[model samples]
Target: MHMLSRPSVLRFDWRPTIRTLPEGQFVAAIGDVHGHDHLLAAMHDAIRRELDELGPRSAAVIHLGDLIDRGPRNREALVRARAGIDGASAITLRGNHEDRLLAYLGGSPAALGPWLDAGGEGMFTQMGLDPWRISPGEFRARFGEDLARWLEATPVMHRIGQLVFVHAGIDPALPLDRQDPHTLMWTRRAWIDSPGPYPEGVAVIHGHIPRRTVDFRDRHRIDLDSGVVNWGILSGLVFHGDRMRLLQVS
Candidate 1:
């Protein structure tokens, strides 16, 4: 099993200091991490190191969801998330895999097969459970309260000052808040075609699809998922000032 970052206690005063972030430029957003525990830990550490070097700048980490799936370290990811980096908010979005996990808990036949096919098998293994044939009784006995925690904690989207962070892209035609659930994680060209720069001037940072799989033309959408499940390096974005540094997960 892979190891993930352990939870840390980082203090921050979100009340007024958050208003001090620079008024401009860019911030980072990370792609999907389907249970690749070690890679996510390395990426998180690297981003912190970058922040230390930059100093007193406003920035945030947009996590595009799927923290649990194939790699076997969801618990670790949660711990790290609870640890905050000063002046930086770790915004984690909900992914389709997460939806399936919730549905599986509710005994949804539709979610079971696909969840298993999409590397959810590893997630089950990490939990010390079997995904192949998860009886309803098995879920209740094993995951127990942990399942509820995962669903309750997952976030749908974040609007950090001017940046909009989500697991996927916006509906383009509609306002960010009113976006359809399916479109958030499943949108493609249509969402990209709609005219607008997020909410007026806000830049939207999102992740779900792998960077390698999408056409470079659509790179404007900021895809961070580098497919770590298939030996693909985890990818992330670091924002400092008006420029964003693209990084591959170590």
Candidate 2:
């Protein structure tokens, strides 16, 4: 297991933090995969080993989303994440990338502009499709039918105990149930630069904006995106009994 201390860039605050999970229960939250299937596969194995070392217990795997686009093995990465540990043990949130792809397939031509530049080129290339000529209707008919359904079905946010897992940050100003889905899958500055934890006091675990490394600085939010497709490492956070462990792979 790779250990990461809190990032030094975090601002000073005096709020109390939860250092561990309840006994016999463990949660591992993975970072943005982009399209690196190898890194994700390694992470899966690492989590399995860690769970084994800890002995028998209830465990949950949470994927921070951004499972597609911007990398060399887009399709494979999506398959790996969707297959997950026994399929039922992991919860995958919906990221903005998935949202954009769904929109493009759902007939919003404008959505394709940003989606393509953000990694759609590589994704389409990997799938052997002509990104320039694939019509939204044809894309959906030929290849997007199942993909659209899966992406559309993904939840924008997932919560367990005191941890709220999301593809992106939440608006700390609103109640958890009242949080806008758009904000849950896209907001950045508002939640990251908040004065403190959410008013509800739950810590958020999210991935969207890429960071050079995992972030565990703020007492309220944990960022796991390590820019894996851009030569940075993929990161994961393991929570058990009040304390947490960091896992990463380049």
Candidate 3:
């Protein structure tokens, strides 16, 4: 796969659909978008074609977050999501970027640089606002409702039969509902080192570390963050019962 620089975007072979679910297969966890609307569209098209081929009444789509930033159409992406296609099977999670925006809105200084450096500035710039000068109150007053609603529904972890879908990784030590947002949005090592029988029989399926491997340690948990903003395509896992398959976006 190739990721173009300048305005980074991923390029890779894309799959139109899944033919089999292997009995218990249900959810598809999508990686970060970082505002790459074109790639998102291609991904959506591929997903839809596949679903159309496979039937939407059977499987669900679980987007692992980082849905906005980097690319040019953050707002439009949200709008499309609001429209909800492929039979309303869309589920978007809150990535660290969204978390930072929430923190920025809630009045936090730590979020500024990271946000700006990671393309949050572009989104604000697109909206005709200077990322540096915006205040929390002002931010909330401006993007509050929509963002709040987006965050409110973003799931920390998705449990489908035995698979656990999360944006980042869970503390594994902390019980599911008890896990911290920080862990859910960033912790990597803890998730990798997580011993067995973690807080229910849930096999942790997650994203965050954008890599080529799709980085799976245990057969149960998988990471699909293929670094779309870095020019890597948004990747996903197609599960057939306990077996998992990879689908890349070009």
Candidate 2, residues 108-134, lDDT tens digits: the string is 778888998777887777767796787
Q: What is each predicted model's overall lDDT from 0 to 1?
A: 0.64, 0.77, 0.67
Model 3, which residues run further than 4 Å from truth? Answer: 1-25, 107-114, 140-144, 195-197, 240-244
Worst 10 residues of 2 by lDDT: 6-15
Candidate 2 lDDT score at position 9: 19
All candidates in order of TM-score, best leading: 2, 3, 1
Model 1 lDDT vs. the true structure? 0.64
Report how far residue 176 has shifted in candidate 2, in Å: 0.4
**What is the Cα-based lDDT of residue 91 in candidate 3?**
74
Question: Clashes in model 1: which pairs?
Answer: 25-242, 31-225, 35-71
Per-residue accuracy of model 3 over 28-130 as CA lDDT, tens digit each: 6678877776666666666665556545345777778777787777766655554445553677777787776666765777777777776777678667887
Ranking by lDDT: 2, 3, 1
Q: Which candidate is the best by lDDT?
A: 2
Measured with C-alpha atoms, the lDDT of residue 98 in candidate 3 is 73
> Candidates' TM-scores?
0.75, 0.87, 0.78
